[model samples]
Target: MSTPADPGQAEPQFILYLDGEAYEEELRLLATWVHALLLPVYAREVTSAEPWCPRWWEHQEAIARLHGLWLAWQELTDPAAGPSGPALWHRDHLGAVMHELRSPSGPFAGCKQGSHRPKAVPVVEAF
Candidate 1:
């Protein structure tokens, strides 16, 4: 467990790690960042070879992956992170996440430009 610097302040929650309202709020904030900064700057042409889901939020894998990317973006783009921070973010975080999210066999595998396909979850036997 971690303590907040201010007694009344709540501990920050990571997006995928949150539940209920906290998850919803974080998703909204993440959507704003995704729309305002991430997509405008980094969105590439969507193609069959590199698929993208119109409703990425519906995909659990995408939510988890994007949340991680967004967290890294927040940390690495801060002024206190220094001059090479953005470069490091680009090299270390951007490429891998984007590739994973956009690859043909990714979460959006069967999705088209304006369509969102929900991926099926694998079944596991309970012990």
Candidate 2:
């Protein structure tokens, strides 16, 4: 059996689980990475089918998915992850997240190049 990690050293929570200032701060950082690095390096031509929202943060699904990708990136790109860290990140995390977010039926489906169309939340009956 293995010992539990110390509470003080617990891993960071996912962004979707965070609220208030924590969410805002993390989202800001994520946006920086998405714009400065991810978009510049990998963004393909925008099209109707494979759509991309200019305001992706508006989409809860996008935020959750991207936040997970960013967390993986942080860990996998670290020097401690070894020489293949970056390559592993690309193979495992980056491609899947990007594809899902940009797929024709993905989160940004109705969004256009310069427009952001908010998706309606499905209503649920209260218990």
Clashes of each: 0, 0
- Which stretches of model 1 miss by more than 4 angstroms? 1-11
| Residue-level lDDT tens digits of model 2 in 4-121 | 2333555767888889998899899989988998889999999986799999999999999988888888777767778998999999999999999999989999899999999877
Find the 10 residues in a row with the least total lDDT in model 1: 1-10
Off by over 4 Å in 2: 1-10
Among these predictions, the greatest lDDT belongs to 2
The true-versus-predicted C-alpha distance at residue 46 of model 2, in Å, is 0.5
Tens-digit lDDT string for candidate 1 (1-127): 1123335756556676789987888899888888889888999999999998889999988988888888787777767778998999999999999999999999999899999878977899999
What are the Cα lDDT values of the candidates?
A: 0.84, 0.86
How displaced is residue 126 in candidate 1, in Å?
A: 2.9
